[model samples]
Target: MNIKSVNKLHYLIALIAVFTSIEANAQEEIITVKKDSIIPKKEESKKSEEDRNVMLNAANNTGPREVNIGLPASVGGIMIQENGMPVVHAFWPELPTRTWRQSVSLAKPGLTKLSEVAITQGELGFAVSSETKLGSDTPSYVGNISSSSFGWIKGDVNASGKIAKNLYYTAGIYANYDPQSINFKFTNWADRTQIYRAGLTKKFENGKGKISILYKYSKSASITSHALFRYKLDGKVEEIDGFKIGRDNYMLPNGRFKYLDIKSGEYKWMDAGGRDNESFAHTVDIIGDYKLKNDWNLNYLVRGRYSESVSFNIFPTGMTQATPESGFTVKETGEVYTGSANSMILSYTPRTPLKTFMARAEIKKKTDKHQWRFGLTESLYSVDNFTNNRSFYYQAAEADPRQLVRQGAATGNTDADGFYNYNVGGEHHNGFDNKLAVFGSDTWEISDKFSLSYGLNLRWEKLKGDHYLTPRTPGFTLADGERTKFDHDWFHIGGSISGVYKITPSFGALADFQYTENNGLLTSYSGNVTPNLPKTRSPLMGLGLYYNHPNVSVVTQFSYLTRNNYLTRLNLVNPTNSSQNQVETVYYDIETTGITADIIAKPFKGFQLHYLITYQTPVYKNYNFNAFGNSYTYNNNSVEGISKVLMEIDPSYTYKDFKFWASFRYFSKQYANLTNVLFFAPRWETFGGVNYKINDHFDIGATVVNFLNQRGVRGSISGAELITDPAPYNDRLMVGTFIRPFTVEASINFRF
Candidate 1:
């Protein structure tokens, strides 16, 4: 049936239930009294029979048994119950074995209930997911490159439940495994890694207290095979003294390597060889919580972690390289070296507003015409530094002076124990109203057809950080000739005001204004400079219309924002004179306006649709300067202007013990920059899946993502000038060398 018919039917059912309940209540209240003075034993029996008949009729009229269809076992929306309460709806047998339930029970006065527990109730479930990449990869310029194919598998098993009415517990074990191998022409290498985690939690006192413990471990090992070719030259002709050319010499020049043959040549150049590295990490955590009363709570948490890694590169002292095709001898290299390092991280979060230390007090009261609630809170946060160490390797010949005789000479032996260390320390504080302030509201009953609501929010915050860096050897210094110690402090106060007026039950208008003032110290010891933004301020305003209904809502909003310009500098010392220095400064300012529209709808059962369109124009003004006295500035430049539209549709259907769903998303072309010279094309994506229950204890499913075979690139660049190169986006392109539509998943669940 159509949506209208379905809605009408639901209304009719609700009305029937209401009328039936009223009639049942009236029948239950019926009381029969007899004139006992003249009543005999037969009269009393007749009265008793009438009472029994009335009770029977009342029972029949009370109501029908509510057949609650449990929520979907997986991949489905939750249902909202009457009075806006959320109720879980699941398919029987397919529901997740582990579930969490929270509730508060009333108890006798003075004796407060204090049970707090997080419980996971479910049967045993194991799931595995994996992904693999295939190709002969190329090296990356930024860091060490691994040209190989790799894949990993992850799985977990979990169970939780309440042991008693007030105590709860949950435990789970997770594991991950990855085996990767790489092939560089004839050389090949492989590595196997594994990690595991286990955790448990216990809760007590109606739910007033909780205790939890967790542990994790990880390890990996790698093996490799390597080879090298050598070549020899004799005047204009290259040849091996005791070798005969073989079929392997397919691409060799006729006279370049005609003398050397593979059959009689000494196997001087064997496989280059491989190495093995092993590493592991372990972690432990403990946490506890306590509730003092209905409005107060406390908690504590601590964690510790340890990690180590070691590696050894194995190789022969002397190995000769040969030509790619012709087996001509070239040069011999020396033995290889290996190294390793161990690192650690320690951190703690104390009791504060965001943690355990902070507390809030709230007072709530109601009057015939208005209601009010006020609350106050204070909080603190802190974080420690992160540290790491690394070891290096060196070859004997790498330090040899003979290498200087060749066109190029190898640098001195690498540091056998080189490492870099750095740390970051910071803390923050926050104080603000716990709730939005409300002054007045318009109501249809008190006013015309218009209704409105106005509210305010206020917040204050502070942040400070001190960062340090120390390099190996000579130790580094900032370009400004200053020691490597940087510190800064920032503070801000911001708030927003919002109001809404209803034109009709389903339609409304809204307006909101936000403003913030930020002040911070800009210090660069290296630059020996500081700047201030005492007048820095940001403001935003929005106006919109909202249409809301039982199954759908549409919103159209226009917003504008403006921000101040801020500048900072970086110091660099001159090479010729330590006292002479050069500095660089960057300045920024921005303003933007946007119009957006969004729609949410559920026109069919088990389905939802979403659509959004946004148009925006953004302008930026910037200035840059270098020590060479070169400076450039762009004033009120429209850096980017774009219009975008997005549409998403998801539909689901359920049959006897089976569920199916499909979704599609589409995007319109987006323009960048006021010049409108650059743009991105529209893209589309589609996904579909099906799941079926084999029995009460098991089910299986499969899903395919990106079924449309659509591919594109996205990225941005910023510097002295605008960058238009597409390389940033190219890295994200899908080569489509693999299957167009790729994915297959299956699972089985067991409950006892």
Candidate 2:
């Protein structure tokens, strides 16, 4: 079917489900109550009196009822009653609620009242945000291409409300625009891109049960200048073996002239950057509780969901860069020779579609003091129409000996037989995942001051994939003269156990442990080679201690994990000719440990603080390297991984109708690879913001980010060098060149 047909079908199915649900809900009784004086004595009278007293005691209570208005008024302000009841009136673009319960009445008419619905409540909101840098730096190059400074702008609007007593609807649209320019010193380029998205949701609520439907659509477009490096040789190119092209004297000393030639050229590069991925999903869920005569409440839930995604990629070549002067200058004094254009240049494209479905069921029994829950879930995944393509280019050149005697002669020109001469091939990957799981948790109060809770979960999964390759180039075939096909299936099993114990009124302790095992195969389309990777097993554990008080709370945790053997590629010198060879093999025993701390404090009025810190150590053991026809070993104990530390702090304060907040983050220098001068550099960042309320309907705020313009460098040594010398390997460090040091933005908010 065509793309349009598929989208229509998906929409039809969702619309049908929504209408059916609405019709079913309409059959129920609908009642309307008017505000009147119908008072109940004793219990009811006492509750009302207590609620009023609580509201009177609150310091910031402004409404007739008790509620805290923490959010912006435009976003649907918050309201809390003295009785500890919460009321929300915000239109969240992503999550919308339909019903607005303005008030409650104790008077009962006839018939049973299992639930009530109101239609008068709904909200709509709009917001915009933007950022700009405070500093400038020269653009850095990637693969010899430079990149420009970065910035972005975004805006969104959302609306939600109850369409009927029991039905609600919400929808919103958002957009983003970003433009960037890069200066490669030798060359400069720029790009501009924009994205737009819209989504809708409908929900039905009855008592404690709800069902929801959601749909979203998004698209993006971008334009960019071509970027690449190319050089033209002065020689005759030859069509070598099997469509492969190499210079007739490619490796010969001073082969056909110029050495160290540089050139600059322009071309166009365009792609969706993989963001064109689109998908649709549907879900049906039911959750309710039944009270038995024995005072036991039984809760049951069932849910199912199905989704599919269509994604595509395309890359083409014609796109070429120009060559710079040969030997410092295009010597007009001599005759030069050039080569043929039979060599293949490679390009790639990918396209795929995936679908998945899942279902789960759970049951629970609860009492005033304790609760127990158990559930089982399963999932099915599939991929269809998966395709990938690769293309190659070939070429040769020669010089005119007669022109070499005097002034320069036009450098020999190069040409290609046709774009079709480039070899192209495509591959497809289809995969699926099937999972089954069960879990249970319980919470109990052993005593008035001490409580305990624990949970257990277990899961099993099976993964499988079908891989194949198809050649698209005419008259070009693989060594085996056939397309490659590969298949594999693997399984994993894991479980977790966690518990929390309250040691005192303000302190607690928690612990958790998890373990999993997996086995799979590594397949290669190169000559039908398929290798099995060793089974891998990993186990993880965590322990934490917590402290809580009226003004502050703290939590500390320590975690450790270990993994079994894993396969990786290695490079080694050939035994006969000393050429490099690549191979894959398993390396066993990898472990990591980390310690973390979190703190929250509210020591004063209108003030809050949050802090987090973590330290980690990762270790690898039993290092074994394998190459085609060769194997090497290293002392497992000699490898030392670098240590790391990270910390963040956030603080906020509000005074005299003005609010301010700031955050800071720090990262210590870390060892990135087995190199001495190439450690990961340390970095620090900070941001802050302030807001002022001009009146009930207006407010203004400004925010600044990355105030410290800090740069970091990540380095690594080339594996090829490591295999030969192991030491003296030149470090490849990507240094942070330019950064926006800081960005400041101001926004004005409005409410009605």
lDDT of each: 0.29, 0.33
Model 1: per-residue lDDT, tens digit, 25-66? 000111111111111100011121101001111101111111
Q: How well does each candidate superpose onto the true structure, as a TM-score?
A: 0.45, 0.54
> Each candidate: how many clashes?
36, 57
Write one digit per residue (lDDT tens) for candidate 2, span 1-752.
Answer: 11111111211111111000011001011111111111211001122210111111011001121111111011111211111111111111100111111111111211100000000000000101011000112211111111112333434334444555555544444443333222212111111222221222223243444444333333333222111112112111122232211101111111121111001111212133333322233433333344544544443334333333322222211211123322111233322323221122222222233444555455566677776655565556555533322222212212111111111214222122112222223333455556566666566656664444444445565656655343333323333234334444444444444455667756666665555555542112211134344556656566777777768766777766665554332222233331122223344465556677766688898888867676665445676655455555543322221335767687888898798887776656543333222333465556677879898766777766555644222212122213333222232111111222345555555433
Most accurate candidate by TM-score: 2
- List RMSD in Å for every model shown: 23.4, 19.8
- Evaluate candidate 2 by giving its C-alpha RMSD to the native, one decimal: 19.8
Q: How high a TM-score does candidate 2 get? A: 0.54
Give the per-residue Cα lDDT of candidate 2 at 685. 56
